[model samples]
Target: MSLQGNLTQQVEAYHNWKKELIRQIGRYRLWLQDNNLFSDDISARIRHGLELLVEDELTIAFVGEYSRGKTELINALFFSEFGQRMLPSQAGRTTMCPTELFFDRNANENYLLLLPIETRIGDLSLQQLRKQPERWVKHDLDERDPEIMREVLGEVARVKAVSTAEARALGFDEGMLEHDRNNPGKVLVPAWRNAQISIRHPLFERGLRILDTPG
Candidate 1:
């Protein structure tokens, strides 16, 4: 089957599974409510426990240095059905920045959201970046062509030049500054801090968010 068709089947399976889970959780909630009539102390503990199961999105984060087979590990664990590497894995300096993959059930299409490195120099904090969608570059997903998928996802390797002074202000120390000295006045850095890709993978549809951080 094609990638999309495979993803759709996976997602459908996940949806059916989630429906059963929700039903069970709902029944548990009603049971708890009924038990609350028996005791005040027990009710507080049950309420606290229930709060943790509040149907929130679960995030799975990966952390490590460049290479070390981080992406390769993810590909093997979750994307093995591809029978190929789902992510671009290089031996060194691969996955230059963080990349997040998640499913947006409401999203009409798949795309990658890139926040420019320039955003770091501005007054906007990471939280504000989400609010300013205009500052991001969105690349539509093209799974039909392997080369296109490679090109779009490869944006994580994008780089830009920053002045020495500005780079230091962003927490770069002297050692890093000296190593990246380019023309005595600037330094080259990854063009983006993180990349968010929306795809139709089954894990994503089940609130499975994968964070491929600089590893």
Candidate 2:
């Protein structure tokens, strides 16, 4: 066979595989929707599986010095309803840790899943511990226990009514001020990494699915 013919064959094979995968995803989505599988118990795994399909998914990290309105932008884009409650945006370390928000059809409960850099679930919020990544853990992606993921994320989402002094101690307050001072110039806050996630929700068929990450 000619080399060009072989190349064409290979390309055709890849296209077939891609089409098959998409078809399978569509079927699964329809099945899930019919069965009403959009529950917390299954959302995380469904999300993980969908994320693995993209060949070159983009990871856009919202990076800027402190208080550059990165979180605000996220809020505007992904989290507007939560913003109205004056929710704890003052946690100081908005986007302190690298947060990868992706789409999962199975996530019914609106909660955060926290995974420690290591294997310790002491009483620490993932968002709060952004400045101290080394304190309570090792980063282990091979571990796929949804329960563990839930534990970690739950801790991260547990926001407290922080006092002014407490806020200063954590540097969230300082970061905001620094962001304001640096105005037009870039503000340097904790570096936050993010991923572009696209997933088919069981509820929303066709091109409709869950998209975006947690703020």
Candidate 3:
């Protein structure tokens, strides 16, 4: 559903503000060139600023202890129109890993990308891993199919039973992991280290990113 009330107004205002800023900056850049009043460094800086403004994102992060309803809050705020919870929300640790919800303006297609937990065994950080798309599992998203979407998104809450050594290799502390009741000598860890969900939603399309972090 489209944004409503004051939020709608705010988003519109923000868009207008960005448009005006970009126009003014572009004008300034042209004026500087027309009058030969600025150095090359100044011109480059102004161009960079304009680019940054166009690509700026508004990110909202939900952080709290487990079972504090972060995922539920996200559903209520952004995914309620789906007629069901878009992200896993339950009485326990539903969001197993850090998940980022955003609209991929470049792709303009819905999809989910999950980075394996074992990626942590290497020295690469999450930001670095994001550049290596081959390391992530990709799933196409279809909002038209709620059941399939739910099932696909359910991957975010998945856990795998691993030996203590494997858990340590993934940089998970024993205290932070839950023992798998079904397996005596294994502990359960998040199957995925991180998740990126790209969807076409009004707010998300406007560069609004929502981050759900596990406790």
- Least lDDT summed over 10 consecutive residues: which range in candidate 3? 1-10
Superposition TM-score, candidate 3 onto the true structure: 0.91
lDDT tens per residue, model 2, 1-215: 85434634554565567668877977887788789975665667666666676442323356656555655554444433333411123444544454545443444223333343222224555555645644433322212353443333333223333334444544555445333242444343332222122222222212222222333
In model 2, the runs with Cα more than 4 Å from the true position are 1-54, 82-88, 91-93, 106-110, 117-215
lDDT of 2: 0.41
* C-alpha RMSD of candidate 2: 17.0
Candidate numbers sorted by TM-score from highest down: 3, 1, 2
lDDT (tens digit, per residue) of candidate 1 on 85-188: 76778776777668888877877567899987767767878787887879889988865665677677778777666676666766555355323455656676
Best candidate (score: lDDT) = 3
Worst 10 residues of 1 by lDDT: 173-182
Each model's C-alpha lDDT? 0.72, 0.41, 0.90
- RMSD (CA, Å), candidate 1 to true, equals 5.5
TM-score-superior candidate, 1 or 3? 3
TM-score versus the correct structure, for each prediction: 0.71, 0.31, 0.91
State the TM-score for model 1. Answer: 0.71
Residue 206 error, candidate 1, Å: 1.5
